[model samples]
Target: MPRTREPFWRRLLAGTLPLLVWSLHFAFAYGLAAAQCTPAGMRPGGPDRALLGAVTLAAIGACAWLAWRAREVPRREDAGLLDWARLVLAVLALVAVAWTGVPLLLVTGCA
Candidate 1:
């Protein structure tokens, strides 16, 4: 059976959504850390690790879902560059989110 063509906007979104999500995650994580780790009120611990973990997990989940959706494209003979890009971007985003989240787990506070 032939697949219906998706709109260009939709195709572009699926291809780059992962990177978008990753960028958001990166910004949020660092922003939160910086805001909470001020010298004025040097807390005993670092930023709110729990909240960071939750956001990281949510971002990872989003990336994983996107990657799963694009999984079949790699197996299709007619798949184009955008199709491959979608899968690659999703996987890259997933790894990036995980890697960024690691420091939150290890670092205590602004020490």
Candidate 2:
């Protein structure tokens, strides 16, 4: 049986959401916090400890969910080879989120 043509947007969504969220989380949670705090003289702690913590947690959770969604992209008989690459990206995204989040825990802000 012939496979149906999947749309490019669908493929991009399936592959990139996790990475996108991870990047957003890293930039906003850490970079924004640091930038905000540095100017305001928050020093060792950026955008309020609670706010930073919440952002970090949210990022991790979102990335994990995205990774889960990516992992669900069907690896069965009709699965496209791109599915493998997306799954890998999902895993990498999860790692990126965790790696970026570690600074929030360890540094508590910018060092």
On TM-score, the leading prediction is 1
Name the runs in model 2 displaced over 4 angstroms: 1-5, 41-47, 72-75, 108-111
Q: Over the stretch 33-111, how does candidate 1's per-residue lDDT look in tens digits?
A: 8888888655578888889999999999999999999999867998999999999999999999999989876788696
Model 1 spans with C-alpha error above 4 angstroms = 1-5, 40-42
The TM-scores, one per candidate, come to: 0.89, 0.74
Backbone N/Cα/C clashes per model: 3, 0
Please write out the lDDT profile of model 2 over residues 9-75, one tens digit for every residue: 8887877777788888877876766676675666654456676678878877887776676666665
